[model samples]
Target: MLGQIDITRRQAEIADIVQRSGFASVEELAERFEVTAQTIRRDVNGLCELGILRRTHGGVEPPASAGNIHYSTRQILNLAQKKLIADLVAADVHDGQSLAFSIGTTPEIVMQALTGHEGLCVFTNNLNVAFTASANPSCQVTIAGGRLRPGDRDVVGRSAYDFFTHYKVDIGIFGVAGVDEEGTLLDFHEDEVSARQSILANCRKSFLVLDHSKFGRTAHVRGGHIRDVSCIYTDRPVPQHIQALLEGSETRVVAAQDTV
Candidate 1:
């Protein structure tokens, strides 16, 4: 799996173009980037293989499915942005608080950021989060029981939902698979949506943590709205459409860069 650092500048730009515009032909991308058609094809092919883009008849487009990218790839994609968001979330977190974390790479990064905090009670269905939070000796970690998903390193389903229903935590931090234009919170699986809903219902303050890439993305399962969360933490300002949806609501948007 190629990390963010391994992706070339041209390749990265190509990905951005496709993601934003929906599709870009080889010739058009080459002309836009001032590269040869062959070079553009190479880049598109590589991205397609990584599941970052899907190859069409004469162009490349964002993956047209409800499923998310592979877990290994997701771990490395936008890693720096995720870390920045994590730092912001950690800074807002104080010691001696109970936190409910949901499954996803960003939340795992948050767990890493919170490792220095003392006296935390962490409940999560993500094994990665539990392991990271356990690094802090003063933290108490309780993991949900379910069949483990080896690829994502998390547990979901009825057991996970029931586990979260049993506790009301100070903070609930979770990441969504996508946020549509209507502000609908989306996830790839029903189990994931159930677990997230459990966290939102049980937590005193719900924090929706996601990077800019998730702004207009799509997913299969939909169960909540962005307004349901107390705050949103992202690496960049949300799109104007999404901003409009937050109007008249108390849900605060926090861009990580603005904190610095």
Candidate 2:
């Protein structure tokens, strides 16, 4: 029962749980507020339908979907810029190259730029990217085995982890939730971290593609530091101090602004 709680209050509570705990389990939630599991299920279902929550095995999580960038959101959100970066990155791919792609909006843009490629094997942890590219005859897309991630469009987990252990690729194109002088790449979800780590292991080179906004931001899970990367492509050049910190390391700072 709602117990006289206003709709706003209920929503506030839901938001609190998702933000603080990552996800809220159905059974625990049912008993916490004197409701049946079914009622809590319905509540969660309502939230999912409304795009406020994402359903996972035993609960709901925020940041809402594993493929956080929905098809609709991808259409309207910083799309032209993503396309620009994608076009540049796509130009770097040669025929018959083996590549691994991480799941992110920018990488998806990369896939779009590769619309007419042939004789290339593109391995991915992203179900969305895989689906988008699967129909193309010129490109072969492989989806690593894994558990599907919620609020994000990738498949991750043990199966995906194991598959990457034996496969090596020429490059891994990754995204970050944030980048810091500490050299760490961060993302909002731990599952995403695992997928990134696994992908990194299977690739000969790691390339991070992030927009200027992602710099200096903080995310909960750190994938690795810049020392672990071969290059980072961003919208603008990084500050000088930050460049010095990465000098003599594997990291090469490339700015799209310089190309323009």
Number of the top candidate by TM-score? Answer: 1
Question: What tens digits encode model 2's per-residue C-alpha lDDT throughout 30-128?
Answer: 777678889788777766675566888888886455523343333223445566767767777777788788877778777777767777788888776
How does candidate 2 fare on TM-score?
A: 0.70
Clashing pairs counted in every model: 0, 14
How does model 2 fare in lDDT? 0.71
lDDT per prediction? 0.88, 0.71
**What's the lDDT for candidate 1?**
0.88
Alpha carbon lDDT of residue 78, candidate 2? Answer: 48
The sequence of per-residue lDDT tens digits that candidate 1 reaches over residues 92-191 is 9999999999999899888888989999999999998998887778999999998998778899889999999999999999999999999999999999
Q: Which 10 successive residues of model 2 have the least lDDT summed?
A: 1-10
TM-score for each model: 0.78, 0.70
Query: Which pairs clash in the backbone of model 1?
Result: none
